[model samples]
Target: MLRFVSFTLAIVAMCNGQIAVERDPVCGTRNGFYGIEGNCDAYVECRDYRSREMQCPDGLHFDPAVAWPNYPCGYPMEVDCAGRGIAQPAQPSAECPHLYGFFPSPKATADECGYYRMCVDGVAVEMACPPGLAFNPSNARCDWPDTVSTCNAAAFLGFTCPPPPVNEIGELIEGPVNYKYEGNCFAFFSCEEGRARLLSCDAGYGFDPISGRCVDGDIIKC
Candidate 1:
């Protein structure tokens, strides 16, 4: 698991840096994406390489070292650098499902069969599949999906695989209020008062009116 010492430290390290040089497939936007791209919520400004402008919405200097490259999937596997061999960040453990992660497309074709392909920055990398599973490009398996809701495949080594659309969310820096005590943190999530059946909470923390809670693996935030 990737652990940050403090939320303030995390903010100092992550927010308001340039978006990964690559483009975000969803909105076809580069330099940033959604609410995160260059928001400066963490009190920093990321310089847009194209515009060369330095602006931090939250009022902090951009830290080049902490910038998370913008990728299509929330947690993309590949790292993109302009003519640079940027090492990829490690995938987060399953205990915390919201961190960035990686996955493969499908097995390659017969000609390319036996080839294992991992999706990096939404692009497929051709390589030999690990022992056991034969490459089946048609299936497009991102890591092996452990569909059993109760199971934590990512937590166990060698038995699980990365979930597709490698999604990510910031870690829980604060505790919750208003909700009554629940057995665990994951269970506290339930639908808001008047909302439809959306998602349930894990235990200690219910959904954030702002960052939305995880409901059936779908992220529904305010």
Candidate 2:
């Protein structure tokens, strides 16, 4: 767990070896933001020889590359906290792994791939992806389950994509293809990169395997 301390207080606390803060060219020599030693989420603001410690918001880190007065902080993924390795301790909740970010739902099941949790200032809010899509934690967005490792596309949709067609030489044909999802008139399987992704037709429409497209639901037999 990381701790934040003002520049002055840090010097005093260093003796205990509990928290190590950077001590360098004193602040107030220049009007700008300076990175705190060993702390990625904290910086010192200098104005007219006056200094005040500042901290980036939750889930963000100080970006020395950014200039002053323009908000020199950014998301941890975007900022490179190389030497300055320390960060604020995570404030986790039952539904939130961090104070601000998207996380997989704790209650998600094999069939419930669309559920996710959004954390804002330590508060957790449950969210769900639209039908035919699954919550992807890698990129923090809703995507096809086949492309998301955590969600097994075949198990979730109870369908598997068949092997791709091959030519006379037995070379795998590479292209997009669709297949009907058995027992579900509204859904189908879209195959890409040898993975099966479950897709759905719009309201009042059903998948037509013969035509390989969605058609009017009234004319399609379930």
Q: After superposition, how far is residue 162 of candidate 1 from its true place, in Å?
A: 28
Estimate the TM-score for candidate 1: 0.18
Clashing pairs in 2: none
Leading candidate by lDDT: 2
- Give the alpha-carbon lDDT of every model: 0.32, 0.79
- Candidate 2 lDDT by residue in tens digits, 167-193: 899998778688998778998888877
Runs in model 2 lying further than 4 Å from the true structure: 1-33, 46-51, 65-70, 80-83, 93-95, 130-133, 136-144, 167-171, 179-189, 198-222
Give all candidate RMSDs, comma-separated: 23.2, 13.2
Per-residue CA lDDT of model 1 for 1-222, tens digit only, reads 346556556676567762336422433233442233433222222234232233321112233344335322221112222233232333333322212222332444323233454443334455654422344333333232132232233332122211222225744323322222124333332222211111245533444444444343344322
> Which window of ten consecutive residues has the lowest lDDT sum in model 2?
20-29
What is candidate 1's CA lDDT for residue 19? 31
